[model samples]
Target: MTTTFESAAKNIIGAGNRLDTLGLAPATAGNYSMRLADGSIAITVSGAHKGLLEKKDIMRVDASGQPLEDKKPSAETLLHTVLYEQYPEANAILHSHSVPLVVLTNYHSREKFYHLEGYELLKVFPGIKTHDVRVSVPVFDNTQDMEDLGEQVRAVLKDRPASSAFMIRAHGLYGWGRTMNEAAQVVEALEVLLSCELETLKLKKR
Candidate 1:
């Protein structure tokens, strides 16, 4: 079912609050969006603190990311739009910056993907039936050029059609799903996996 702008805004606000409380969306570090009923996107405005988001902080943008409202969207708005265009089933998308993801990605800078295996939380992602499998989450270098970055992301998605989330080196993670709740679940699960990886690395060092 298509969601109205009002409904999308409410969901976005609630999502922001939850993520912020969990320390995922710190300060103004993340952005949240929902694909509205008419195909326009309801996204958080630029520079708004995710934890303190209000209805006025949510603005509309077309599928191609042209602003339909006066408010400016996030600097990485293109990333969210491109994800929606590439994944038709995704209705809600979230980008979050967490300490574990930031540290883990930087600690493994040479790797193009973060691999999670033997994790019970792996079942939270689509199509995974058990904890025996490995999930490779793509990692891309951070860049200010959205067009180039978007192209790189699309190429990766084309190859890995089942990937549910990706990370930006030294930056954050982008996750999405068919619903806002599902999207949050994916992000939360990914965060926990990254946290576990970090803890394991610390144990190895000790």
Candidate 2:
């Protein structure tokens, strides 16, 4: 069932709080959304510090991402909409610029894709039941133009759909799920694993 604006907003606000606590949505640097029953999107408005989001901070846009309210949506609204269009089962979308993710992606700049494998935490993503699995998170160079960037993202995922999340090199991660909880799970699980990977790199240097 499609979620309601009120319900979606509440979860998104609460998600903002949770993400803030985990250092994921630091300093107004992230966006969250849920696709509504009426085919509109309930998303955090642009420039709001996600950590302090309120019900009013959430706004709606049409499926094509045209604002349904006076408020402007996130600049990457097209990115979220593209995912929704491609994966009809995805209801919740998250984008964050966490430090570990940024550091890891930046350090691996030459690698077009990063691999996540052999971690039990991988189970956090749907359809994976074992730790002995390999998943490649596509990494795209950062871009300012949303239209061009969104199309690039669409092409990457279309060519080989991401299992749960994708990374914007030196930028952050984008993840979505069938529900808010699942989306949060993917974010949290990825956050944990990325931190671990970063630490491993530090240890290797030591």
Clashes of each: 0, 0
What TM-score goes with each of the models?
0.98, 0.97
- Give lDDT: candidate 1, residue 114: 88
Q: What are the per-residue Cα lDDT tens digits for candidate 2 across 1-206?
A: 66999999999998899899999987889999999999899999999999999988899999999999999999889999999988888999988788898899888888878899999999888888999998788888889888998898788888755467888988889889999999999999998999999999999999
Model 2 alpha-carbon drift over 4 Å, by segment: none
lDDT of each: 0.93, 0.90
lDDT by residue (tens digit), candidate 1, 1-206: 58999999999999999899889998899999999989999999999999999999999999999999788999999999989988889999999999999898888989998899999999999999999999999999999999999999999997776777999999999999999999999999999889999999999999
RMSD in order of candidates: 0.7, 1.0
User: Which residue window of length 10 is worst by lDDT in model 1?
Assistant: 156-165
Write out the backbone clash pairs for model 1: none
lDDT of model 2, residue 147: 93
